[model samples]
Target: MTILITGSTGLVGSRLLQRLLEAGYDCRAMVRGGRPKPAGAHAVEGDLFDTESLARAVEGVTAIIHLAAVFRTGDEALIWKSNFDGARNLMAAASAHAPHARFILASTSNVYDKSQARPGCESDAVAPTQAYPASKVAAERALCESGLTWTVVRFPFVYGDGDGHLEELPAHLLSANWHPAMRMSTIHHRDIATAMVLALDGKFDGHVVNIADDVPASMLDLIALSRGEMTASARPLAEPWAMQVDTALARSLGFRPTIRTVFHAAEQQLL
Candidate 1:
């Protein structure tokens, strides 16, 4: 089936595009700012602000993996336009052109506030404190309210080779050793891509699932794993960012990820 992927050049989107192409699926990539599209995929150049451009991108596509969104630290307006409005625009286009197609929207676990206890589930209340998470919540709401066939995958921090966050963690740790003891949930980028493909074929429809690896590590454990030193004394944040996702939903649907494999992938990239 033809699958249209937004943010085809990003860390997660690029990897997902490669995997989808390798699997012999017809892939269409929607990109912004005239960036060159990856080979072996149909490239559709357009901006999210332009509804007509977005409609053209979704036309004739069987499925859509919505991954395009802003993740900047500042600039609320840009974040809102890119994350919330952009997502709404795409959803509207998909509803109009490909309403029956499987639409997978990549959301984040950060939609849960810091006050949330560990092992957050899909049914947990959404309390987005940051602009990024707020935008994701807004996007999720829009998709759910649109009455279209959609699945929202709330992903934890994804890391793997060529990941910008993995590369910067060492420097961020070394500079101030401000290693808060926050519980970090991570999934390999490959796993995220794999899950997306599985969800497309799986029985779960119009449901939200939390996609993450089996193991959840604290910041201290991550530092030890990354730097080979357990002496970094950055206590865990009082409001730890721990998420014990009920993978039961995904598991019941026949999806599981090897946490060890993901960890090894991150280690290879970090060290």
Candidate 2:
């Protein structure tokens, strides 16, 4: 089967491409100019905003793993265009070219309310406040309402070696010298890639799954695991804190990872 992955050079996309190639699947990657393509995947150079290029990328592909988007801080308008509008363009292309292709959207757990009940389920109402989360919600809603087969996976604090987002956590903890005993969820990149492939191959369809590790950790626990100490003034983020995800959906699909493993993996990457 031919699987097309957007943002093929980004952290999750790159890892997913590696796994797809190892599994002997025909993989096509969408990349920006000047970026090198994964060795085994077909590289298509184009911007997500470019409709013609997006259509070309989707043409004849069996499935699409939509991972491309503006993730970090940026101008509000630019972020919306890249994250929301880009998703719209990709969906349009997918509809026209490969309507039956299983489209997997990489969403975030940030869509849920910050202070949610433990083990948040897929059916819970989304409450995204930040710009990034808002854009992701918009993209997710578009795909769900679109008359196409799609699966949305909501990731909760994925961490792995060379992850840019995880790298920043240490800085925040150090600069603020603050920590709280708040439970948090996380997953390894390898597990995420594995789950994505499984979702594409398995009986799962049109479902929003929350992917996370087996255990949750407090901020203090994570700091200690990283071999760092919290200052006396360290404090936890206010109420409406991020809660754990209900990975029961993911587990039913046969994917699991231990929190100890994830924490150690992140420690190796951070320190």
Candidate 3:
């Protein structure tokens, strides 16, 4: 089966592409003008804003892994356009050209409310304060209502594989005043590809699922694993469970994480 992957050069997409290719799948990556495609991926010159390019990108593919999004941006408008508008354009193209293709969206756990009554789950109400998560929520809604076979993979904190995501986490948490005791869910890069392969096989069709591992790690432990340090504090955490998610749904849907925790990743030298 031919799978069309968006955001093929970005961190998650790039790693995922290599995994898919190694698994011996026919992968077509959407690339912009003059950008070098990763080896083993067939390249298609596709732009999120360009309807013609999007149309060309989706044609005859068996499935689409929509990983393209903007999260680390100061520009709110660009975030909305790229994350929401770009997804809508791709959905439109898929609807017209590859109506039978499965559409898998890569979303974030940040869509859950900070004041949630319990651990975040797929069925909970969401009102994200940040534009990034808000736009991802909007994109997810579009895919659900687009009358296409769809799945949404809401990633928690994706790190590992020497991608530098973990290395940069300490500063972001420190600046945001995150409590050292506040535990957060995470998934290694290898497990993400495992979940995506299941999604491609219709294991999670027509559902929004959280893709996480067997364990959640505290900020202190995570920072230590990254070999970075966080300021120690016994201060109260206003939202201890804010970033945590419920992964029972994923396990029920047949996803068993290969890297069960940050410790597991460290032991395997995957971090």
All candidates: TM-score: 0.89, 0.88, 0.98
Error of 3 at 19 (Å): 0.6
Judged by lDDT relative to the true structure, which candidate is superior, 1 or 3?
Answer: 3
- Count residue pairs with overlapping backbones in model 1: 3
Index of the highest-lDDT prediction: 3
- Candidate 3 per-residue lDDT, tens place, 1-271, comes to 9999998999999999999999999999999999988789899999988999999999999999999888787999999999999999999999999999999999999999877777799999888879999999999999999999999999999998889998987778746778889888999999999999999999999999998888899999988988888878888888868888998899999999999999989998999
Residue 238: error of model 1 in Å? 3.0
Per-residue accuracy of model 1 over 113-210 as CA lDDT, tens digit each:
65667677788888777789899999988988987888899888777756666545555666744445666677887788768878778555778888
lDDT by residue (1-271, candidate 2, tens digit) is 8888998888788877887899898999988778887788899887787878888899998889998878676688888888899998988999998898888889888787866755578888886777888999999899999888888888888777566555456668756444466667887787787788777894457788888877777766666655556544344456424667778877887776633455567555532
Write the number of the candidate with greater lDDT, choosing between 2 and 3: 3
Each model's RMSD to truth, in Å? 2.7, 2.8, 0.9
Off by over 4 Å in 1: 173-181, 228-237, 240-244, 259-262, 266-271
Query: How many steric clashes does model 3 contain?
Result: 0
lDDT score at residue 64, model 1, on the 0-100 scale: 88
Please give the CA lDDT of all the candidate structures: 0.78, 0.78, 0.93
Q: List pairs with backbone clashes in candidate 2.
A: 114-240, 115-240, 178-234
